[model samples]
Target: MASNPGPLTNWPWQKLGNVKYMVLSPFVANSLYSIMSKEERERDVTILYIYPFFLWRMLHSQLWISFARYQTSKTNHRIVVDKGIEFEQVDRERNWDDHIILSGIIGYIAVMYLPWAARMPMWRWDGLVLTILLHTGPVEFLYYWFHRALHHHFLYSRYHSHHHLSIVTEPITSVTHPFGEIIVYYMLFSIPILAMFCTGTASVSGIVGYITYIDFMNYMGHCNFELVPKWVFNNFPILKYFMYTPSFHSLHHTKFRTNYSLFMPLYDYIYGTMDMSSDKLYETSLKGRKETPDVVHLTHQTTLQSFYHLPPAIASLASKPYSPNWYMWMLWPIPYGFMFLTWVFGSTFTVERNVFDKLRMQTWVIPRFSFHYSSSRQKDAINGLIEKAILEAESEGVKVMSLGLLNQGEIFNGNGELYLQKHPKLKIRIVDGSSLAVAVILHSIPQEAKQVLLIGNLSKVSCAVSKDLCRRGIQVAVACKNDFYKLKLQLPTELCSNLIFSTSHTHKFWLVGDGGVQRDEAQRRALEGTHFIPCSQFPLAKARKDCIYYSTSAMIIPKALQNVYSCENWLPRRVMSAWRVAAIVHALEGWDAHECGDSMLDVEKVWLASLRHGFLPMVAP
Candidate 1:
């Protein structure tokens, strides 16, 4: 939204939410019905192509989004350096498809009511030429002045500022304008199509090609990377005036007072509105700089559908917590195809980047899933990937690298200690974040509670929590005799009195780190109002509505944490896993120690460091 909201700022079907796409159902149904009932000679070809074209436009824009995100995440050819895209920008750009709906509505009206549009041929060479000419002559000129008018203080605050909200642009950010502005842009863009209709030269191919050209230029101009090879302009200097590069438009976003042309810099040149720094910025962006992070969080894929939740996948989906959606089942083959690709060519890929004060951070994913770690045949490959990632981080001068999720599983990498054993002189400190995980788990227990049920396989974090609770004089009840024995062996003789074997699940607090099946069984046994605080990295499924389920060991990141648009797997927005935060805190405080394998850091010290560094405990709602 803009500062002073104006009329039609919101989309017409905005209230419809996800179901807004149903607005096109009438047109789609009618087009399909016509195709089925009438022969090819009798059916209107242009009308039949409308729905498919809309889908094509959507796919085209999404491809740009994925491509742009992938390029910006990489160190090469990035135009905007250091700046990160935030969630606010993702949400504002989510409705980029709104223009498709608007165009569909207008196309439906033209095909149904306009005689020339009702009977258009599929292709015409003259029509294509006319569209290019008209767009360059009239459309480009009009848009340049209109764009300048929009930047005026009055209209900028009321509408255009919303589009300008994303200074570090993405592909979709090009179309993320208020509805009122989009309506005017459609009017300006319709000149070529309407001209063709009036001149009796309109063709389906002409219409599709022109709109596609617009989308392509919009994406190319706004994507925050310099992709257009400099050789093109170097050889054909005249083309520099005819076309605008990504860096050319990036200057407009930064300086905000120049380079007002759309796709063409000819007008900006003619009107003397071009920025002087355009060519320099383009050259600098082409020779991209390398970005080395101070801290790295190493994570892995979880469920099959998690591929879609990656930052480079879908913006809206990635911004929210991951969940199994019924719709994802229909696209099941894609995930399998991705898995196959990972198997063939799997390596660490950068998932996200962030900045905290002067500390640069990044999250790199091992191209393996949870189930892959369980397979003995794939264990070596998974560890190899992890080892490769650690070495890569070390080579990049990363101060700290934290192992997240199953990457730190004892059976796999012995809580990330195997690498240290193999390479004892490694400078990059490998952190399992066990200390902070233990702190978060222990802090979650209510002060009034004297007894708590501890049900889970014996992991480093669980054992640490058990020992801490026992030392605090709280009864740590375990249902499994095997787990009880393990806890007794780990704890000191004085703390052994607090560890008791009990099958009772009536405890109000359950410290659960068990697998999904065992956790479900425990939920069934536990009484209503029980609080299930997870000590393990994995979160438990909520089996009972009456019982309260807290998130896995995590913390609400400080407001200063930048570029936290995507959720950390199942955790909510702005929430970081304790392990990830621990690594960050370790870097921030200049802690020169490794917390992995059987070794444990001071839980209290880690907890206080986190608080001092602005990571707050995630209080369960």
Candidate 2:
């Protein structure tokens, strides 16, 4: 987390505030039936005659189709967890059977009463026309302006930022906003409704049907799950342009600024708001235009060529050497992990005896120690294990260090006093970016040391300390499991060079490295000593006959294991620019024996520029 709360300016839909319009469709329908003329009420075209039948048929069709599929595919009832894991559905008894009977009675009254008043309006089928009009063009045009307004600097901080709460949104989250926000979000919908209503509109039924259809479309579009059949997606290419596909909307959510059109891409195309279209054909072309140039251009093919890579070249040319900057490393978790290892494991890599006179030995002293709160509220037993490493360092002649003040406040001042009472020996000093305070403290020590142990928020003041110490020619080694875990998880795999959050079904070690080589190797060793319950195959274990039990924990292991090799530059030597790693994984896994429907896949070529670097060499060449 950053030192400050997220900026309000970045909230996705913050501008929608304090707007509401009560929708009384059923009331309007009922009133129409009660007040309508006899001829109007007696018309055969009344919705009262057709509405119940249409609804009954639709519901029955959905149920019968769904049930038939469920019987054929035994796993159809499985609820998708994380990654590829699925859970068997359990039957639940329902006591709300009476609600159906009450609903039918209420429905009968509304149907009979509404037709009488609504009969005159039904003559033109204006409701359907209005609904179709809204869906056709106007909505997207309205949405673009509203979306752009939300992004405006003046309005973004307060009114437009709330919708960005979830980086990845689910369909249920589509309309889940503050009550005030929802009104503004749907204000455009009311335009056509109001216009049609005032102009002898027959749009009431059409509007209702339009809303119901759009709800399904929007829900399916936002749903991360694969709902639309692949065959349909493969055959109907134009459908993607008209209907927002999951990938289409997901890309928008991921990028946030482009692709604001909903229901259709027409407005975005006309307005130049469309960031991507299936017509463009290659996904990478879109990303290539958007990704930071420096990041995308970094090549690993020839070490000599990358020696000219500006950032690393500048660092290498420095008259005085220091620990790697590790600034950008934190932005990506997996590379950060490798960088952490590259630092902590420096003792194994860094030249111990060197000709450089500025280099000196130093020892870290901890006057106090405390375990930080882990992602899991439960006490992190791993923290205790890490604390033992600190103690071990102390026994080996290094001082265990503690923070005198956290970024929030003085460590021992308010909450620190009680905390320090438990561990008194650890030194506490107010550390910001100012190195003078730390230097004064370090100078006070008379004994020469080889290493300094840093504890607490290493990325903050500790990062500065490491840079300062390493610049003075000290081998600055950092031991942070949290840092290690985070970096390792984000390291790219051969499948995709870019870092992405590894999808895991299990929540056990989300913030920890459960899949790193060290982590997995530890588990592999532990399994020999004890019978470990493989949770991935049997999450919340039950009697099962199938041998292929999906273990939530095991799924992430592949990515984590992939990280070690990917970071180490082992596999996927070539870059496949337009393909997503997940897409590649799906293709490679052969889980679905379907044909490679995307024949255009071969049209993709590696950017000779993209594969410029073979991976940052683990060693200083």
RMSD per prediction, one decimal? 1.6, 25.5
Q: Counting only residues 3 or more apart in sequence or on different chains, how many pairs clash (N, Cα, C under 3 Å) in candidate 2? A: 55
Give each model a TM-score. Answer: 0.97, 0.31
Q: Where does candidate 2 stray beyond 4 Å?
A: 1-124, 226-240, 277-621
lDDT of 1 by residue, 282-315 (tens): 9999888898999999999998889889998888
Q: What is the Å distance of residue 326 in model 1 from its true position?
A: 1.4
Residues 1-621 of candidate 2: C-alpha lDDT, one tens digit per residue: 112223321222223221111122454465456446447545534445444544453343333323322221222211221121011000000111112222333334544665432444433565667667765667767776777776666555454454444343344334433333444655665566555555666443554555556556655544443344545647987665566555556556656777777667666667776765433422322222211100000011111221121111221111121223334344355433433553354221110000101211111112111222222332233233324433343343422122111211222223123323344453321111122222222332223433343322323223333444444544333235564354334333331222223222221111111123123333332212122222111122223232111221111112111101111011122111111121222222222221111111111121111112121111100
Per-model lDDT: 0.88, 0.33
Which 10 residues in a row give candidate 2 its minimum summed lDDT? Answer: 85-94
Please provide the root mean square deviation of candidate 2 (C-alpha atoms, Å).
25.5
* Candidate 1: residue 214 lDDT (0-100): 96
